[model samples]
Target chain A: MKYTEEHEWLRIDGDVVVVGITEHAAEQLGDVVFVELPEIEAVVAKGDEVCVIESVKAASDILAPVDGEIVEVNEALSDNPGLVNEDPQGDAWFFKMKLDDLRVLDDFMTEDEYKDFLG
Target chain B: MSEHSTELKQTPLHALHLELGAKMVPFAGYSMPVQYPMGVMAEHLHTRAHAGLFDVSHMGQVILTPKHDMAALEAGLEALMPVAVSGLAEGRQRYGMFTNAQGGILDDLMFANRGDHLFMVVNAACKAEDIAHMKAHLADVAQVQPVTDRALLALQGPQAETALAALVPDVRAMRFMDVLSVDTLFGALWISRSGYTGEDGFEISVPATTVVDFARLLLDRPEVAAIGLGARDSLRLEAGLCLYGHDIDTGTSPVQAGLVWGIQKSRRTGGAREGGFPGADCILAELADGPAQLRVGLHPQTRAPMREGTEIWDASEGGQKIGCVTSGGFGPSLGAPIAMGYVDSGHASTGTPLWGEVRGKRLPVTVCDLPFRPSTYKR
Candidate 1:
C-alpha cells in the first residue's frame, strides 16, 4: 500500500489500484454525509478531482493520484457515506483505477513516510 | 503560528476548550473551537436529543443605562432601529437589528430590559462598529457601556431546562425570552430563556472569573455536552435562523431577509410613532408593497449539499439566474442538506421547483417553508 500527499491511499489489486482516503483524512473530515463518485471507465489525470466528499462541516474533493482510468466505484457509499468515517481505508475505498504501469505506486509515500508526513 | 493566529482573541473558556480537546479555529478574529473530539454531527444530534453547552463569549455584550429615565434611552434606541423598544417590559428580551441609511442590516442583536438599564448582545465581528454607532447616535440620552468582564454561555436542547433548573431552581419559572438576574454559587448569572438554537434553552452571562466553573457545573450533568461553532451553525441552519454575514448582510434589507416580523406594528406606517429610524422610507415602502426578492428555505432534491455561494437558477440547466444561497450545509437532525437563500418573489412559494448550481452541474432544488424541522422553543 502507498499513500499520496493528498491523504489518499492506493493498494495494488489484481490488475488495478484501489484508491481510498487515508485514516488521517477521514478523521480530519468530521462526518461524511455525501459522496459524488466519478463515472466508471472515465480517464482521469493525476491532478483531476475525481470525487467530491461532503461532510457536515464542509465539502472536499478527492484528486486522482496518477493518470489512469476508473474501472470500479464503491456503490455502497451512495447509501451510506458515513462508511468513509467508519472504515476510511477498508470498505470505504472510493474506486479502482487501471493504470498502464503499476510501478508508478513506488513513487508514493511508504507507510512509515505517511506517518511522518502526518506529523 | 501564523501572524493571524497571534492576533486572534481568546474567549474566557479558551483554556477549558483546549482541555476538552477542541479543534480551535479562527472565527470573527477570535480563537474559537469549531468542534471537539466528538465532531460536528454528534454535537448537533446531542443538542437535539439532550443538551449542549456553548461558549459564546466572543459575542459583544453592552449595557445601556438611561441618563435620566428608561424612556429616554428607549426613545434614543428606537430612533436607530425599527423594533418597538419603548414598550419592552422589564425582564423581557426582544430581537432587533441596527439598520443603515440604505435600510440594510448593520447587525442583529438581542436586547433585554433590565429595569433601570438595557442589556444588549451583538455579534462579535460587528462589535466595534456597533458600539461606535450606538455611541455616536445616543450618547446624550444613554451611557452605552460594553461589558468586557462577562462570559456568555448557551445551554440548549430539549433537556436544557432540566440541567439549568438544577443549578438555579428559579429558572423553572422563566418562559421563553424571559430574562432574570439570579445569584448562584458561581456568581450572579444574568440569564435569558433564549438561544440561537430553536431548542428550549438559556443564555447565561456570568462573570469572566467564574465562567469556567459555571460551564463545568452545567457540563457535569449527564445531559449536557460541550458543543462547538460547527454544530452551532448547523443547528441554526436547521432552525431556519439567519446567520450574520451569511443570510443577512450590509447589502440585505430586513424586508428582503424575511425579518419583517421583527418590526412591531408600533413602528410601522399608521402606528403611534412612525418613520423615525434610518432608511425608514425604503423599509416602510417595502413593508407595504413587498420586496422584489424574498429569502426562502431551499431543500436540495439530491443528497449532495449545495453550499453557500451556489447560484439558484430558474431551470435545471441554467435558464436564468434567480439568486444565490447564503447559508447552507448538511443538517444533522434532518439527515439531509438544507439551505436558505434569496429568490425572486414569484419563485418564493413553498414547493416551487428551483435549481442550485453546485460545482458545474445544476441540481434540482425546491423552495420550502423555513425551519426544515419544527422549533422546540418553550413558549
Candidate 2:
C-alpha cells in the first residue's frame, strides 16, 4: 500500500513522508552502484526529478512522489550506496520530505495490492 | 537497448554469482557480473584501499607449442607481435600486441614463457578472431590450444599479497610479472603476480570445476571481497590502463597509445631483425619520430563525468575537432574526474588546454600525465 508504479515507496510519519526505492527496482538495477542525491532542504514538486540512481549498465531518475520540501537526506549513501541494493525498503530510504499532497497516497498500491500488481 | 541474440557464455562462478545476488549483463559474449551489493564506487575504493576479487574468466587463454622447433614457434609469434619473445625467461610475462601491416594494433595480449609451453591471455571480445588469425598464420610452426574451461580470478589491492599468502604460501615470493604453479587450499593453480589495477596483486588460473570453491575461500578471508566489472573499470582507469575495445583497437597502434615500452631494444636494433614483425617498418618509424595522434590523460574541470565518444577539440586550433574521449569517469581514489583520449601530438603536452564537447556544451579540460595513482606493483 505504500508503493508506486514508478518503483518508489513512501512511509508516512506525521506530516513528513520517507521515500526510498523498492526491492524490485533494486533487483532490476542489479546493484545500487551509485546514487546522486539532491541538496538537502531543496523544494520539489510532485513527479519532479529529485535524484539519480545508477547501476553499471543503466541510470534512472528517482521522481518525487509528492510535492514537498526535502528536509533530510540519507548521507550514509555517500559512502555506502550498496544499501539501496541490499535493503531498499529499510536502511536505503533516500530522503525525508514534508508532504504537500496526501491525496497522492490513494493512487499508490498497498503492500498486498503491490504484490498482486508485481505478479 | 540493442538485443544480441548470440548465446552468452557463463563462467564457472556463474551460479555462485547469481546466488550472491549479482546482476548479470552481457559483455564480450559472456554474462558477467557488473556490480554487487557494494556498487561500483565502493568496490573500486575497496580494491585500492583493501582487496577486491574479480572474475576475469571470459578472457582467452591459450597454450602455444612448437610444431618443429622452439625457435620456429618464437619466430612465428614475433612475426605477429612487436615484443622480443625469443629471449623471454621462463615464468616471466610480457605485455604485447598483434599488429596489422599498417602498424595498427589488432589486439593487446599478455605472453608468458612457461618453459615447455608459451601461455597467453587476450581480450575476450577479440579472442575468437585472434585465435583464428593465429591459426591461419602459424599453423605450420606452432600449435594453438584454447584453454576454454579454465577460470581466472584477479585478487587486487594493497593487502592482496597478504591475503593470498595466507592461502598460497609460495605466492609471497613471486615477483612482479612472475608466473608460478602453486598449491592452494582448493588445489594446484597457476598464479601470476600481476594485474591491470596497478596494485600488488595476483591473477590465479584454476580448473573451472573448482572456481566457485576457490572464490568462496578467498572471500572467507577478512581482507578479500568480490568485485564486479564496474569497479574493474574504475580501477584500471585510475591506473591508466587501457581497455582494448575502447582505448586501443584494430585501428590504433601501440606507439600511439604510449605503449612503446613493450618493444624490446634488442628486437629493434639487430640487422637480422630490422623488419620481421607485422607493421615493423611503420612501427619502427613511429618509434623514431612519434605518432601523429597520441593517447593522453585528461583532467576535466567540472564534476560531471565525460563519457566515451565525447568530442575533443584543440583549443589553439580554432576549436577544431582533433579526437574523442575513449574512457572517462569519476575516480573514487583520485577524488576527481579523469579521462583518456587520443589527441594530436602538438596538443598532447601536460597542462595543455582542451575542450570536451558534451551535449553541445564545451567543457574545459587539461592534459595531465597518466597513472593518476602511483602503481604499487612489487617490481
Candidate 3:
C-alpha cells in the first residue's frame, strides 16, 4: 500500500489497483455525506480529480493516484457514505482501476514514508 | 506560537478549546473552533438529540442606552434600521436589519428590549462596522457601549433546557425569547432563551474570566457536548435560517430576502412608524408590490450536495440561469442535501421543480418549505 500527499491511498491487487482516501483525509473532511466517483471505463490521468467527497462542512476532491481506466467503484457509497469515515482504507475503497503504466505506482510514498510526510 | 497565530484573536475559551482537542479555525478575525474530535456530523446529531455548547464570544455584544429618553433613542435607531425597535416590549427580542439608503442590508442583527435599555448582538465580521455606524449616527440620543468583557455561550438542542436547568435553576421558567439576569456559582450571568439553530436553547452571556469554568460545568452533563462552527452552520441551514453574508447581504432587501416577518406591523405603510427608517420608500413599495425575487428553500434530489455558488436553472426555461445557491450542505438529521437561495418570484413556490448545475452536471432540485426539519423551539 502507498499514499500520496493529496491523501489518496492505493493498493495493488492482481493487475488492478484499489484506491481510496487516507484516514487523515477522512478525518479532515469531518463527515462523509456523499461521494461522487468517476464513471466506470473512464480513463484518468495521475493527479486528476477522480472523485469528490462532500461533508456537511465542504466538498473535497480526491485525485487519482496513477494513470488508469476505472473498472469498478464502491456502489455502496451511494447509499452509505459514512463507510468512508468508518473504514476509509477498507470497505470504503472508492474504485478499482487497471494500471496504464506500472511505473506510475512508484510516484507515491510508502506507509512509513507517508506518515513521515504527514508529520 | 507562529506570527500568524499571534495575529489571530483568541476568545475567552481559547485555552479550553485547545485542551479539549478542538480544531481551531480563523473566523471573523478570531481563532474559533470549527469542530471537536467527534466530527461535525456527530456534533450536529448530538445537538438535535440532546445538547451542544458553543463558544460564540466572537460575535459582538453591545448595550444601547437611551438615558431614560426611550422615545428619542427609539427614533435615533429607527433612522438606521428597518424594524421598529421602539415597539419591542420589555424582555422581548426582535430580528432586524440595518439598511442602506438603497434598501440593501448593512447587517442582520437581533436587539432585545431590556425595559430601560437595548441589548444588541451582531455578526462577528460586521461587528466593528456596525458599532461604528451606530456611534456615528445615534451618538446624540443613545450611547453605543460595546461589551468586551463578556463571553457568549449557546447551549442548544432538544435537551438544552433540562441540561441547563441543572446549573441554573431559574432558567427552567424562561420561555422562548425571554431574557433573564441570573446568579450562578461562577458569577452573575445573563441568559436569553434563544439561538440560531431553531432549537429550544439558551444563550448565556458570562464574564470572560469565568467562561471556561462555566462552560466546563455544562459539558460535565450527560446530554451536553462541545460543538463548533461546523455543526452550528449545518443546524442553522437545516432550520432554514439565513447566514448573514451568504443568504443576505448589502445587495439584498428584507422583502427579497424573505425577512418581512421580522418587521412589525407598525413599520408597514399606514402604520404609526411607517416610512421612518432608512430605505423606507423602496422597502414599503416592495411590501405593497411583491419583490422581483424571493428567498426560498431548495433540496437537491440526489445524494450529491449542491454547494454555494451552484447555478440554479428554471426547469421550464431550457436550463436558463435563474439564481444561485447561497448556502448549501448535507443535512445530517435529514440524511439529505439542503440549500437556500433567492429565485425569481414565480419560481419560489414549494414543490416547484428546478435544476442545480454543479460542475457541469445538472442535478434535479425542487423548491420546498423552509426548515427541512421541524423546529423544536419551546415556544
**Clash count of each predicted structure:** 0, 3, 0
Model 2 over residues B273-338: C-alpha lDDT tens digits? Answer: 556888888888888888999999999876555677888997634669988899887777876678
Clashing pairs in 2: A1-A109, A1-A110, A1-A111
Ordered by DockQ, highest first, the candidates read 1, 3, 2
Taking all chains together, each candidate's TM-score versus the true structure is 0.99, 0.83, 0.97
DockQ of each: 0.96, 0.18, 0.92
In terms of DockQ, the best-performing candidate is 1
lDDT of 1 by residue, B1-379 (tens): 1244458899999999999999999988899999999999999999999999999999999999999999989999999998999999999999999999999999999999999999999999889889999999998999999999999999999999999999899999999999999988887999999999899999999999999998998899999999999999999999999999999988889999999999999999999988799889999999999999999999999999989999999998738999899999999999999999999998999999999999989999999998888898889
Q: Give me the candidate number with maximum lDDT.
A: 1
RMSD of each: 1.6, 4.5, 2.2
Residue B29, model 1: lDDT of 87
What is the TM-score of each candidate's chain B when compared with the real chain B? 0.98, 0.96, 0.97
Give the fraction of true interface contacts kept by model 1: 1.00
Q: How well does each candidate reproduce the native contacts, as fnat?
A: 1.00, 0.11, 1.00
| Residue B49 local lDDT, model 3 | 94
The 10-residue segment of model 1 chain B with minimum total lDDT is B1-10
Query: Weakest 10 consecutive residues, lDDT, candidate 2 chain B?
Result: B266-275
Model 2 residue-pair collision total: 3
Candidate 2 local lDDT, residue A116: 92
